[model samples]
Target: MSRGRGWAADDGSAVAEFVMVNGLLVILTLSVIQLGLVLFIRNTVVDAAAEGARFGALADNSATDGIARSVDLITTALGPGYATNVTASTGSYLGHPALTITVQTPLPLIGLIGLDNGLEVSGHAAIESLN
Candidate 1:
């Protein structure tokens, strides 16, 4: 009678294999979650910037109003943790008064495997100044 080379009728150690496989799966899952979170934050900031830019382009737009609108839009669009970093007058990009909205958010992870911080995104729109 003869058993397998690696299994001599007493080899049932799958713990190592299972651990490796499951560890890989866990890492993959974490990566996906992290990516999703980043994408979500990016989209939210984009939306906020768009909204703020839209408001800023209005005829009666003011510097205070621009900042307030940017903050409000960012807060409303992203719930919390989303901050309006800078809102500036872009002047005219294409023969029209332009306003810029910048948004930022902190990442959950750093060098581990995710974004660090100070991730800023901006949006610009033309002003329809009635004056």
Candidate 2:
């Protein structure tokens, strides 16, 4: 009768196993969510900057317009804090007069401070004329 080391002495391995597995799952889920947030923020900022540059490139617009538009877009989508470092300037794109809009914002990681310099993104559009 007998057959091996008897089906007994089942230590607390199941509990430890569950803990390890669940920990990994939780970490993985959080990482995925964080990545998604980063991507969404990047897209939103880039599009906002581009839209601002386009607006400023209109026949009757100035670099200030681009700055304002960018700030407004970012503030509306994320928060006013994210729009604090917006800037606009005149430039040339492909030999054509252009307006450039730059945006720098915090990339929230653990809390909301993120890196010391955060992330910076810019957009440019050729100036339009009504001649």
Candidate 3:
């Protein structure tokens, strides 16, 4: 059995094609996963901030309490590192008194770690009163 002259020139091309395709697929998959991770982290942080603001807006609670609550939520969900930069303040939102909780966290470039303070989110809740 003999092969054609053109077949010899095309030998080993499959291996090269497979490598390139595989590389591209791997990169695409990793990119999708990373995007999902970023979204998850952002949502978690946002929820924590909102919950903290609501908690702090309670008549018996204060801005400091809100900050503590936000910190605790983020710490438990992600880790202590992400919770370090949380802050809370009392102010007016939509013309009504409110509490705001702001969270600044890493941008998560490569698996749960990235540029520090690259992302920021805030949550606000109306302040409760007994009057």
**Among all candidates shown, the one with the greatest lDDT:** 3
Each model's backbone clash number: 0, 0, 0
Would you give me the overall lDDT of model 1?
0.70
**Candidate 3: regions farther than 4 A off:** 1-8
Write candidate 1's Cα lDDT for 1-131 as tens digits: 66676645445458877889999999999889877877787787777777778777778776557667778766776654566365566676677668877666665563224444457777788878666
Tens-digit per-residue lDDT, 18-122, candidate 3: 999999999999999999999999999999999999999999999999999999999999989999898888889999999999999998999876999999999
* Residue-level lDDT tens digits of model 2 in 41-64: 889999999999998889898888
Better of 1 and 2 by TM-score: 2
Tell me how candidate 3 scores on lDDT. 0.94
lDDT of each: 0.70, 0.86, 0.94
Candidate 3, poorest ten consecutive residues by summed lDDT: 2-11
Name every residue pair that clashes in candidate 3: none
